[model samples]
Target: MKLTKEERIRLTYQIGDIIEQKCRRCYYNRSDDASFSINICAKCPTGQTLRQLGRYFDTEPRSRGGKTGNMPDGLTPARVRELNDQGIPDKEISIMFERSPSYVGKVKNRWRKHRVMARAESGAEEVK
Candidate 1:
């Protein structure tokens, strides 16, 4: 089913998240309060573009392109070291932990600088 600009924008962002509705021509008319309805945002850029393009328009939140997630819990430094000590490859460990291989490698690289890690590399037990 087709969605209106208000519906699409609402799907992408809540009314409170649309605080930065800026345009030189429509700046004064733009709604700044979360109290007002989405229709008050009609003068904003997305609405203006939608006005010009009609159904051919495609819109997504401007900030959606950036990396915007928190690191998942449990993939701690101790956990990573324990996984590395288990003879698991970084790729497999990453898959098991639901993290990227590069992130796992980065974690391992950061941990490698510890003197205990240096000793552990020579068969001594790692001190966490």
Candidate 2:
């Protein structure tokens, strides 16, 4: 996953192309579905991902200008996933995060939900 500087620059340009060509229509068009409705670009998964990538290239972090010093782990769902990927148990993650284990479980669900949302997919896969 590590990329050279030139690769990063190329990737950023590619993402710009995708947003301009593929994701632009979704941003400007209206839709009956709440998930894809107009003005939902703020919540667009592609935009979210691009913004995250931009952060890596920025010299300074942008302050969200929200209330500060909240949550032990900054309430990042990705951190939860990172711990999970390390095969850490939910209970341990919860204790480290100073949140309830059930809350940790819910974060996991939300993480998966956003992932599915990003794909614009429907119809759950059936598992036997």
Candidate 3:
């Protein structure tokens, strides 16, 4: 299908963004062409377009071009405890643990509520 002038311009900008992101976060450096190369195609022997290259890599954070960074590598129990001990905020810790920051934040919030409830119950017992 033929693309209109506007479509072509949009497509070009989209492709350029993909290329830049890929270059920034490329995992495999099989060849120099795969990374740090100004022109992705010139390095690729298969003649794949920038769009195709985006598929080979993982997605980045907040990327607009339908791509994202690599899958998160969930947090471990030991690491979670370590983060708690360090007094690291749940959201920041979650990112380090490769889990959703929101999940960590929710867990922290729940713990806070539980502590408050326990304290209230204890206070009532003292009054009685």
Candidates' lDDT values, in order?
0.56, 0.60, 0.54
Error of 2 at 99 (Å): 1.2
What's the lDDT for candidate 3? 0.54
Per-residue lDDT of 78 in model 2: 51
Better of 1 and 3 by TM-score: 1
Q: Specify the poorest-scoring 10-residue window by lDDT in model 3.
A: 119-128
- What tens digits encode model 3's per-residue C-alpha lDDT throughout 1-128? 45567866777787777667665445444444445565444555333667464453434344465333333454433344557679887788877766787866654455355553344334432110
Per residue, candidate 2 scores C-alpha lDDT tens digits across 1-128 of 45678988887897777666556566444443333222325567766766776666665556885654445645555555567689998888888868777766765575566674223234343111
What is the clash count for each candidate, in the order shown? 0, 0, 4
| Candidate 1 residue-wise lDDT, 1-128, digit = tens | 46787876765554233333433234445434433433434546656554444443344434654354445566655565577689877788778868776766765675676564465556665454
lDDT for 111 in candidate 2 is 50
Residue-level lDDT for 17 in candidate 2: 75
- Model 1 pairs in collision: none
Off by over 4 Å in 2: 1-72, 116-128
How far residue 64's Cα lies from its native spot in candidate 2, in Å, is 25
Best by TM-score: 1
lDDT of model number 2: 0.60
